[model samples]
Target chain A: MMLRQGALALAALALTAPGMAQDAVRSPDQIVAAAPARDWVTIAPQDLLVMTLAPDAEGNPRKVVIQLIGAPFSQGWVDNIRTLARDHYWDGMAILRVQDNYVAQWGQPDPGMGIAEKPVPEGLKRMSDADYTAGSPNWLTSSTLRATKEPQVIGDWPAPMLTDPYGDYATFREGWPIAGIQQMHIARQWPVHCYGMVGVGRGNPPDTGDGSQLYAVIGHAPRHLDRNLAVVGRVVEGIEHLSSLPRGKGPASYYADPAKRVPILSVRIAADLPESERPHLQYLSTESESFARYADARANRRDPFFVASAGGADICNIPVPIRAVAAE
Target chain B: MMLRQGALALAALALTAPGMAQDAVRSPDQIVAAAPARDWVTIAPQDLLVMTLAPDAEGNPRKVVIQLIGAPFSQGWVDNIRTLARDHYWDGMAILRVQDNYVAQWGQPDPGMGIAEKPVPEGLKRMSDADYTAGSPNWLTSSTLRATKEPQVIGDWPAPMLTDPYGDYATFREGWPIAGIQQMHIARQWPVHCYGMVGVGRGNPPDTGDGSQLYAVIGHAPRHLDRNLAVVGRVVEGIEHLSSLPRGKGPASYYADPAKRVPILSVRIAADLPESERPHLQYLSTESESFARYADARANRRDPFFVASAGGADICNIPVPIRAVAAE
Candidate 1:
């Protein structure tokens, strides 16, 4: 995943104008490739949750890497996730559901089928529904806030402000996609359910499941679930391992057959793993100049394959670039 | 997928207000269940493309049913698809690429490998860049046209009009999702790239693809691809067969090893099949009152599990409900 310097230099020379020869227009990937190394931020090992699934039929290892949401957004559930990983709570749990164009859910469900439910680790944070969104206390003075009170505002804020269907405005915060609504002087923000985002599964209201069960969005961005669920993190790698599983036949896509469930071999935080086995990953900083350009290029695709550049882009469409950092 | 009257009646009584008890607020699925049969429209057999992929490891039949685009949108490509299907152009072709969180492409690629490429049937239509979007000559007289000069406007047209990132407005047209920009006295519209949407794959500009190689959006709604690619149809059933395929290792997720490619057993128009073999399907009419209510429910989740309701929704989020009709 290392950026090729040769491709970067060539793309820079080619990025002059749209409607030029096919090879002249720099693609969004090319724009990201030309980004300076300083714009790349390394993810802390403590924030990485690595879950290992049972080997596939061919005996290939199956591992999924998740990047926990940072402070000021769903951190309570994030803390619980880290604790669960530390306690090996999900070590022997199974993937319970694979809903087509919906989600791939894992971990324990409510007990009924002969199997005894495992007791949750003590001191797991019990978060209220209000915890789903964080209060943006400093937004009144922020220069990034658009002045319009309209339902959707389109302008530059790293990228063109989205005509958000879920909130007044949707944008990136600390390399994470977020949507926020301003009510008078108060503003509340929540993580959105873009594809590959990992969320905590719960049963009914007043019962935000304590991160014992989690699921990854495997299809289109289900924005309806935004303020309804606790999005603890996002699957940074190995999503294919889950997304490609056979969909369940039971109602809500739960596996009807007991043997159909895929088992979780282990779950561990990267910091707990040996240094040699830890994953080295970096994400393009949302605040960096390169990300702004990258986001713009995504909104306006001047790439060779594209005949017309879409004048705008959905917030989810402009995914913050993440890449595996090769060891020196 | 049948409407259960018991659940329908129960949900009807529960549809009072937001923040009510969990059981009282009806979910979007329940609203669709309550939709009258008259509100459901039967898809024409000719519009259905039945693609049979090679059986899986367990020998389970993998049949993907695609509903081709109707009149006034990508019809040229749609006609070509019908011709290709009738001619059995994809019988021995293999899935070309499967880029995770992007697309699952299938068809014959340009010859470079040892295998000779299949000769495309004659009478394949050559399309222009202008055909990517259809002129909305009747838009000014349409009752659904919301009058607003703002970048984004939120109001009910079946559902709340989307704050489209790709265009001035995004809405549903005859059961299909679309976006368009108002340019002075003219408006041009194009089919959007939602999850499961199929598009014609082309090389450079003016190629517009000859309806030979095709791809299905297997991830988030890649709105950036709108107006950039010729959208011909959407996979209405068995998308998991394609979406769950292992990612290809080659550039653009193409299969590096030709052996890994899944072969297409056959591709045919559903009308070409025997009456007993044809799949019967119906989609909720986007213009129906039930559809409007369903779209509203999707935008605002008043269900018990939801503490807060998202005031609006992406057009793709409100998927037109399609269900199989049991054989009589």
Candidate 2:
């Protein structure tokens, strides 16, 4: 709650200075609380995946909600996943692996025996190596547009930033953390593999992922997976349900006994559900001025609890704030 | 199991090269399995903290094992902690906090109410800010001695390495990850705050910590706490028991309901226990050549599962392998 309060205060500041003379630096909670309603973007129901897990022996069904990244950002993977979910592809699928401090993956028990790959839907594109990079002119144009606006400053460091050799720049676009390399005219960007970020699991071949098997990061951000995996989106709500799963004990943290697996009840697009049953979720808009301050505060916490500021923050360490809107 | 296999293969490699042509790299399991008995250091019983947690509703007691760092490495804090446990100071203390993606702290519900501070034991010293740095000539001498040993090579990078701006070098001494600066004729080092690393929680004053409240990093490594906190040791075994606890929902992740708190059944020093009851444990020695290779392999994984090796690894990502020794 202190962190939440801090997050709100930070989100409220429009221009955060490293050591500016002020009564006190606003916390992220205060900043977010002071944000205008327009600064909160409602997640489209169609882009939301509501996964209801079968009740355990105790009879409590676990529900997890995911907010898919919008179009042109892992669009192919997202579309393919949405198609698979809509077709009831994962209704009976089980959470196969829950590696401690790693990932919790859900898919068919035997990949080859169950859930044969289906033809790629008409409009959904097959993801490839090129999909990993945002080298297209469109991304550069957007980055340029973002640069025209105020650049976020964390401590004394300005962002769209870079922690090089690791990545060229760490920036945000459409509410996703992007690690990018800026060349002469084009920028190559890809979604970072932060904790709670969801990705499609596949075999040795990069293109083999069809979204039938997916995993959510449950540990320290495995940034090496960046560009190597198709991170479709992030777990916006009910991440606790996913993170709290019993860690699997077999190879790659697969459940040794089939009976130990947690069964998936169903995964439905929020839009397909009745209006009354749909989740009204809103995320702090990355494009908003408030978010810039929020990100900075997270990078360099100036709170009383912190003795020294980290001076810089890793891309994965910064969590995007999300909340479910109350039903009218 | 696959990760273990990979670790084994990586560990078995006699000498790791960044991108050198080799038949294959050894996994940690293999390296450890093939190690000489002498390579495996039996944990001194005196330094082992055996924590028996109160039984769950089903009456299943959860046990956690912590191996305290040896003398001269948070010696004062560790000594204080040992004395407290010896006095049965935390017999009925409840685990007051279980912060999701942060830490699980166990101590008195009210800092001032339950366990009053005890007088310092005759031989145990109180820790201060000076203990935070390895600036002492003894440390510099040892660091100088360590510098003489061949530095570990991971890919093209060398260790005692530095992640930059954060620290001058990332090295290990006595099985603990250390972030240090190799200055002229002296080195300033401190144990890094990596996952599963245990630390003493204290008040606002830097010197206030006396090991009454202790916590383990349960999620991402909060590296900012490196020098600021007194890191006593690491959770050597049964960490899953700690990591899987129900997260508290109150401010700072404290359990909202007092009933929800898990009680500490008892804490015993292994050395004080009957010989038959003492835990049989061994840890891979950090000083060995095998560890150099192990550390390097972890930094740049050559496993088949990983397509691209993170050219460099952060200090936190490298986990020191530990195991329960087979009973004689």
Off by over 4 Å in 1: A1-24, A140-160, B1-24, B138-160
Candidate No. with top TM-score: 1
Model 2 stretches astray by more than 4 angstroms:
A1-25, A36-38, A55-61, A111-126, A136-165, A181-187, B1-39, B55-61, B111-126, B136-160, B181-187
Q: What TM-score would you give candidate 1 relative to the actual structure?
A: 0.88
Residue-level lDDT of model 2, residues B1-328, one tens digit each, is 1121222243322234343333146554555566677667788899899998987666766888898987567888988888888888788887888887778898644553334544444554668866765552333322222221113443322333424224444666777788665545555678877778899897777788888789988887776676678889889887777777777877788887777788898988999988888889988777665666665565465666565554445566667778787667
lDDT value, candidate 1, whole model? 0.78
TM-score of every model versus the real structure: 0.88, 0.81
Question: Evaluated with lDDT, which candidate comes out highest?
Answer: 1
* Clash count for each candidate, listed in order shown: 1, 35
lDDT of 2 by residue, A1-328 (tens): 1121222243332345444333157666767777788888889999899999887556866788998987566788888888887788788778888887888898645454344544444554568856765563333322232121112443322333423223434667778787665555555677888789999898877887877789998887777687778888889887777777777777788888677688888999999999997989998887776777676666556666656554445566667778889865
TM-score of 2: 0.81
